[model samples]
Target: MKDQTIEDWSREDLKNQWLCWIDTIDPKVSLKEGDSVVFPKKRIVVQAEMTPLVKSIFARWERLSPSERFSAWEQLKEATKEAMKDVLPSCIQCGECCRKGSPVLRVEDLELLRTEKIPWSALYTIRSGEPVTSHDKGEVFFLVDERIKFREKEGSRECLFLDSTSSLCTIYEDRPLECRAQACWDQSGYLELENQPYLTRRDLFSHIEVLWDIIEAHRSRCGFERLYGLVKKLKESTAQREAEEIASKIIDLTSYESHFRSFMAEQLNIPFDILDLVFGRPLERLLELFGYRIRIEKDTKFIEIITQEGPFHEEA
Candidate 1:
């Protein structure tokens, strides 16, 4: 769920969830023996005696105004930070955080993108699925699933926009909100406190508190859905020339499909002859031969292919 929707949850419910999560980690609480809690690289036996009280405070926090809420959240986060100082591990800069499959844009991000004069086609392209347009508001943006997939699969499991060679963002200043809000195990300063076992618990709690604060803020903002709507609207309202220009940037269909077929065949270690029988020939013939199906709408610039994995591509 988007942060905005999260914000809509009753304060009490949110608090209860938070408490439940913490309780799962408490050593003093009832936990099955041999049960383990996993962190990035560490797993610890469930202790039966520690109970951290964050949910109660969080519940009381909901009645505050946005500014006040943020402030309170920050304070709580600081406390957690102080407590968990010792157990946090340092990041090895594996670049997993910048991976491509995570969706970072929200409505505000899309609106901001519009302020620039770059043609939408040159700036972004729809992949994996059709652009979703808001029927009511006419906003358009990339779908969340697409964004997630892009982040997950593109550029070696890092973000496509992340420059691996330089360890920099291609769109640093314009990166999405989710990207900006991200903090992994190392960013919270817990690694520096790793030697301080007495402070480990506090530090871990603080890290989580900070994370939840961001989540709550996002829920309140409804940023994710807004971005989707914006992207959809843009696609719908794009000028014909602009749309064509964008379409031109996409890999030509013949080349893309050929390459895709070859790649898939190679990945699966299937023979090229079988691949041709599966994906080659006229659309109807291909469908009849191996249940391969394609649908191309009249006047649309792409073709949709139905495969065992569902509709795989809509390429120009």
Candidate 2:
């Protein structure tokens, strides 16, 4: 077969090519002579940097004229819908889809989740700061919005609803619209995915914005951004006493806990585990970056933020 240039390709061809490029490396997919692709087998890692070539492709789309863009979209949508008309694709039950990642739950799916078959524990939220691959932009970054999604197995990429032995959905009948929209035989299902409505933090937490506003206010006042500078200064100081004093002043654990607990309980009205994901784990990890280990004693409700090499204080 003769190699076809991207300039000669139709909009639908480009869309399908982009899909395959992101999904997996396949020889069947069309590409320029030297296009390099990365196939991430797990959830999109936040740290992956976009190459200049990928950035250029994104810029090209942004510069498209209205009429030119409309023509392209029309072709893209018609091709996707047409993939379903001829014959419904057959599923060999390979379980690749489940292994790739769990589906993001739609708002309508949240309503059905009230049923006994689908417990709330089976879900997980990818909050605003979590990273996910953008199907359109082909880049990964901290998401601008909170997304409710089905949980994956504890240490595996397979969806929680997928039965390992059978390669079938445990909650097949009660699966979300996103799951229903996927078809093993056709790429169209994945292409048309943006049409589905996703559930956000605001849908479940009525006053989350209030908590966010307070958190933002605290962030501005707290100087969390200066953490790295404090760490660097501590590393350079000759006196251990001075370093300890600086560390204590830099991390106001008391102030953070008091304000955070108040905002979580009174303002946000969210569960404790939600707070752990949204604030606790992140804060703990941040401290770890500065050579501190955080240990929470559940029995006595104590928090110990200690240095890796020296004596530390405990709080209750």
Candidate 3:
């Protein structure tokens, strides 16, 4: 095949060239290129550094748009992960990973939830399409599918399961698949595991017809995707008149969510948190995740978007 100039090549073509290039690098096993992580296979500790060829390809990546960069990164991760069927590394009881982020639940972990005494307060849902930190990258991106994650301790990112003093998992015997699969030394297993089917609200609650329908309706109405777009508009709208209109829509949506959460908590006699296992974290909390700070006035009916820098004002 004749080589097309890089600018003329499609992302897929670039990705293919990448696969072919990496395939020729060395016969030894390694996870993927980019991140400086080593994979121990056959006693071959392949030092993962950017070779000249790898650097050339990454230089091409520098020219890509943000969306294109993410797409290419995903494609590369998927393609390169299949080669890394690594030996699982044993844990040394360091809680650093747990302190960094909570494990995302996988389908294999569902049985634990069904049989165990883990409370709803301990877990929260990440709605499909919600922006969340990627388990592998730590970069915030919209999820392609919904996930349930164990909540962190109050005011800390440490996993609720991690015992800080002992550096042990409180639920060591019955940890989620993500936790079981994770190895800071060799993320190949974790990376491969990430592509597998994961638990969703539907998987847990779909059996109850009335409950499922209500959850679906609530997700459709109060989803973070809509709020994210509105907040983005709130940030970018240059016109005061248009900004006011956008802020009003934001407040109206917040009101609907507040009332629904209150009504559901009251009617079901379940803590408002139980609903978070289905619909996702409350809107106020999610707004902060999306990079907006929320404050309620005396009325307590609407959220005021506040930040150290510029924030949207309802009056203006």
Determine the C-alpha RMSD for candidate 2 after optimal superposition of all C-alphas. 16.6
RMSD of each: 22.3, 16.6, 15.3
Q: Highest lDDT among the candidates is held by which one?
A: 3
Of the two candidates 1 and 3, the one with more favorable lDDT, higher being better, is 3
- Using TM-score as the measure, the top candidate is 3
**Per-residue lDDT for 142-214 in model 1, tens only?**
3433221222332244555666675566666666554554434322342333232221112222355643453
lDDT of each: 0.38, 0.52, 0.66
Q: After TM-score superposition, what is the CA distance of residue 70 in candidate 3 from its true location, in Å?
A: 50
Q: Residue 7 deviation, candidate 1, in Å?
A: 57
Worst 10 residues of 2 by lDDT: 41-50
In model 3, the worst 10-residue window by lDDT is: 41-50
Model 1, runs deviating above 4 Å: 1-94, 100-104, 114-158, 186-307, 310-316
Q: What is the TM-score of each candidate against the true structure?
A: 0.26, 0.47, 0.67
